[model samples]
Target: MDRQDAESAVRVLSGYPTEEEVAALIAVLAVVGQAARAAPGPEAAGARPGRIPAAAFAAGYQSPTSWQAS
Candidate 1:
């Protein structure tokens, strides 16, 4: 999607974010969408809770690490 399309979508979903913020959000969404599209289809077509595809990690997606006291 182009910048205008991304801005329009962000406007509809958000409350007046700065243009820079909208652009950043769009970039992030694009990366996530691309990763999702590249991932292989579900294995065996059965529900599996808490199972993230390995491709997502390879694409730089990370789960939240446990918080540690500094």
Candidate 2:
């Protein structure tokens, strides 16, 4: 999603997220967005071996819980 879409979704969340939570969300979104934009399209199908789809990457993501872990 684009910046505006991200902003809209955050605005609609049930409860207000803490500043740190929002920052973390934004960071995750930024990484995913960059990956999605950089990902090869269907035209490059079968060109790479063991290529993981971006969706799968996002689905398997584990956010860091503390500064030390991060």
Candidate 2's clash total is 0
Give per-residue lDDT, candidate 1, residue 12.
56
Deviation of model 1 at 26, angstroms: 0.4
In model 1, where do residues sit more than 4 Å from their true spots?
Answer: 1-14, 43-70
**lDDT of each residue in 6-67, candidate 1, tens digit only:** 87677757788777777878899999999998887565455365797777779987666623
Off by over 4 Å in 2: 1-13, 43-70
Q: What's model 1's lDDT at 19?
A: 75
Cα misplacement distance, residue 39 of candidate 1 (Å): 0.5
Model 2 agreement with the true structure over 1-70: per-residue lDDT tens digits: 9996676577748566667668878899999999998999665775356565676558975434544586
CA displacement after TM-score superposition, residue 3 of candidate 1 (Å): 27
Candidate 2: residue pairs that collide: none
Each model's TM-score?
0.41, 0.41
lDDT of each: 0.76, 0.72
